[model samples]
Target: MLTKSSQSVATIKAEDASKNCILVFDPDKTHAGKLNAILDFLGYDLLLAHSREELAHQLKKYPGLLTIIITGDLSETEQQDIVNIVAREAEHILPVVLYSVPAKNEQPVSLRYPPSWVAVKYPIAHQEFSSALDRVHAHFAHQQTEKGQRPAHLFRSLIGRSPAMQHIRHEIEQVGPTDATVLILGESGTGKEVVARNLHYHSRRRGKAFVPVNCGAIPRDLLESELFGHEKGAFTGALTAREGRFSLASGGTLFLDEIGEMPMDMQVKLLRVLEERTFERVGGSKTIKADVRIVAATNCNLEQMVADGTFREDLFYRLEVFPINLPPLRERVEDLPLLIAQLNDRMEYEKHFSVRFSPDAVSILSGYSWPGNVRELANLIERLGIKFPNGLVEVNDLPMKYRSGTGDGVSHDSQLDFFAEAAAAVRSQPFAVKTKPTVAQILANGQDMKSYVSEVEKNLISQALEETDGVIAHAAKLLGLRRTTLTEKMRKYGLQRPREGRATG
Candidate 1:
């Protein structure tokens, strides 16, 4: 039994006892002293108590006692009460013995219980007590070993410990154990397939296959046959009967990627399959029962599609019985480091050359919005490994497009000219083909608008340069022009002379 406070009703000195041994009992002061001394002399360690109440409370604090020696003889009902407490409340397996002082006339009283414990009288052989204690310790050790050897497949594969990930993990935990339909919503390049895999692996259908089908990839005429299978000769090219994703995944999970892209007519067929758990192959008479689980994902606004009548509202609700929404990479920028580390590990395991991203490289990465999220990051890292194998990827090593903010490394001048030319095209469109010109237009009709446009560009460029502290790169950003374009314009307008005085442009 566990030790209670020092102010226990009856206390023992607690001398040299094996770590595996404990003694619990209720005894009068005189009897308690005698019992403690005898047990000490006999090499038996003891934990004492004033009553059954104290003993039961102590048991909660310590676990696994080899033997318990209950000291005085109580009534049969009282003895059974103590036994019940030990059987139900003990932390781990502990063999128990009821010890009583030698009786005046006949044999001492003994109580019986299940095989888990033992009952013995006092003045018993020392060897008998020690042997029973050893047995209790062995039982607990064996049980712990068995528990440690269970398989890893019992849990899902998605791994992250951050608070944001924890919330996502908890949501997955709640639904992964059930058979409910799942809907995953996120922007493109987020790992929707990974989440779907986690849901399938953690569910009761783990051992079965996970079939993923992209609805947008198939043409309208072929999509129905692709999803629902088809009988022989259903179409011109149909030479034999074929099983659709639903039938193929009958005992597992079917993940529909970009389900919002599925045609409206096909949506009706899908709803029927979900509602009835049965479907008919194209040109087939028999309706086949399907036991497949559904895991659908989309980056589109499904509610808006439903509202616009492009998607069936009932089908949308059925697919969205449970939803898991993923945050965009920009919102979870803190996760970038961990994600990069994980990606690096994967690259190494694939036998790719080792690489490292410079601190400045990471800083640049963090500043961007990651329009494509994790998938885009993964691709970037893989590309870096391939391009700069066995080397450090400094900020300068980054592709020029990414560093320049265009994502395609086009020359700064070319980007500016593209935008300026596009603006010019819109301005030059015929505004009035047959309308008569006003007197002011007749007077100025011969003047070129080109000079006026150049003057407007010059004034805006000078203001942007002043606002940016004369940093041409920053000025270009402010004016939505490339740095090179801004420099060229500054020269054309005689504004590029070295600034020796305060800017007055």
Candidate 2:
């Protein structure tokens, strides 16, 4: 018989145990020794706990423990106590195996245990114990796989660890399985379509098609026909009957991007379809069932549009059943490091080369207000990858606007000082010519010097606005220009900031 003193004497500290270590609780020294020999022969690490107190201590010390194994004579109450401790402290549900013999005059050992726990007859054959251990190992392996699995829609996209992103992910998981209409609202380039795709992939309609149509991109006259099919001879170019996006996306999802840009007349028709779950072809009177989940996205404020009588209130309400607002890149600046790493990994995969950004480079990039959001960041990263495929990108390696923070709201004197600092940093490092052309090369390539200079000036001004987060006075100071002069230039270049909302980060 396994004695408590013998079992307790061999107790192993949970902190020193390996990740694959198993917690074995068996008070009987004989049974514990037998199981220990079996496990040790199999090259498994074991942590023996003789009592509830020891078990609790081991659990607290090793939150990353793999599984638990209990053998010998364990009362039902003791078993319950062990399970309670495992369930309460474990990061995830752990598989537990209980081996026990029937007591005198008692019924056969019951297999009754928690879903995560398995009970087996004690004094079992070595083969049976081996099989049980195999099952436990398999269960642990499966759990590890599940922990690492990403949502199908999240493959190669939608990367972030911020609270806002985490909340968005939770909302997607909650709403993706339903057939309700989802309205996604965010600024432009905020990956609204990505969210829609994620919803479709996670929903029951994943196997079917995912048809996306940008309402703003399509001509107003053809928008209706694009959404609903047209019959033969429906219009000037209707040579044959053709299925619309709704028909193409039947039994799946239809992502309506920039829904706010739809015309008022089209909005009424859309509202009717949403209400009835059916639509008629543009040139045909036959009503067709949509059978497609609607996911609408917009950068415009639909409520404000409704107040202005531009967007139909009924359609807005129908689309807003489950609204998900995506935060812009500037709002989640803390996630920049992860985003940069992911972006660079993608670049390396595609280009067969990689570049590491220096601390200063990262600082400059993170400090800027990403007005264009993730899309702009992706573009900038790709540009860098193309320019320097495999090299350390330092502060001076960054663009002038980024290095000097010319758009980040520093005073004129401060901006000048930063420029001096940037120039010194650049001078300290050896200059390396990039594959891209210089301004002199462009001039020699027969490009108009005046137009080229004007374009460069315009780009500088745009970067300034972006860095200053669209603060006109701050941008003017960064550019060392008067507010009126900056305003005039902004007007000349047709640069306008969108209406402000609640700032984050």
The number of the candidate with the highest lDDT is: 2
User: Where does candidate 1 stray beyond 4 Å?
Assistant: 1-162, 404-505
312-410 in candidate 2: lDDT tens per residue?
Answer: 888888999999999977556545655765566555544555555653465566556666888888788888878876556777888877666434453
Candidate 2, residue 181: lDDT: 98
RMSD (Å) of each candidate, 1 decimal = 27.5, 20.3
TM-score of 2: 0.53
lDDT of 2 at 383: 85
Q: List, residue by residue over 278-377, the lDDT tens digit for candidate 1.
A: 9999999898998999999999999999889899999999999999987766545445545665565455445434456543455556555567888888
TM-scores, all models, native as reference: 0.50, 0.53
Model 2 lDDT, residue 91, Cα: 43
